[model samples]
Target: MIGKFLNRINELSMLRDNWNYEGAKPIHATVCRQAKALVVRLSENILKSLVVFPDVDGTLLFDVRSDNSHSTIFVCDNFFSYILKKKSGNNEVFSGCSWNKDSDVNAMISKIEDSLS
Candidate 1:
């Protein structure tokens, strides 16, 4: 479960870093795995530092500070078992990433289309 999360986060960071050389702005990325969540503070299209929770729980945490001290985001995220099982609230939003524990540590993350009010 965590391997995928790390890979995805790394992938995002790498993507941001790649964009950096070309003059793209850096973006923040948060990842959660086994109560160990990580928040990376990026600057000028590069990863500046990180904030990690070695022991934490719950869903959807965000870091709003400019320094990115320690907070969580409304990621609209949670965990479930499999494709056959669905127990989500109708009004809830999903981030479109699923981890198949039964299978390889591989996880699939998708870009979520959120409705802005």
Candidate 2:
């Protein structure tokens, strides 16, 4: 599962780079929405597989910020339950979340990287 997530992430990153090389001004909203959904879906699955309690209730929200230089993916549950942020050229950061469990956060990060293989 983690492998799949990383593959998708890599694919998107490459796509974005290609678009930039082509001198594209901005990415389309639909594409962004789709990408955000995929991230949320994969995150949710990771959370579930870990048996993390208070499972997400299908209320994941994505806060995307991007400019000519960089992009960010912020995922959170409704009511700010949990927030995960991944920025261009940086590792994923767990800003805050309702879980607030260090072990869970560490495990999640590990899982995400595990998929990279």
Candidate 3:
């Protein structure tokens, strides 16, 4: 069943795209990490998506995770997650956000890269 949401439509589309990717068609338009962080450029916005499946309320909404057993925190309604994701510049783990072109962007980029390493 569909739980809570910040951006469900985008999430649904990404799931479809990833499913297609698993079938070997390989839609190179979007990118999704093994840890479930994803970024897809739609129109003029780079849409980032995080998994918060089947959750109604917690920290998992703000932090990146592969599990769906936690709460789905909608940041548009969550000032805390908004601040955290904004500061992190890597909201690719969440359902929605506006991009910031600043030093924080660089820092977040570095953080994600370091996670990869």
**TM-score winner among the candidates?**
3
Give TM per candidate: 0.24, 0.24, 0.25
Q: What does candidate 3's lDDT look like per residue over 1-44, in tens digits?
A: 12223244335324432353343222122211211232221111
The lDDT of model 1 is 0.28
Off by over 4 Å in 3: 1-38, 41-101
* C-alpha RMSD (angstroms) for model 1: 15.4
Q: What ranking of all candidate models by TM-score puts the best one first?
A: 3, 2, 1
TM-score of 2: 0.24
- lDDT string, candidate 2, 1-117, tens digits: 545544443444334323545444333334344344444444443433321111122222333222311112233332122333343444445444333454654554453544433
Per-candidate count of clashing residue pairs (backbone under 3 Å): 8, 3, 0
Which residues of candidate 2, in runs, are more than 4 Å off? 17-117
TM-score of 1: 0.24
2 against 3, candidate with superior TM-score: 3
Q: Model 1: per-residue lDDT, tens digit, 5-104?
A: 4554454443443354555433333333422332221222112212221112223233222221222233323432212111222232334434334221
Range of the 10 consecutive residues with the lowest summed lDDT in candidate 1: 108-117
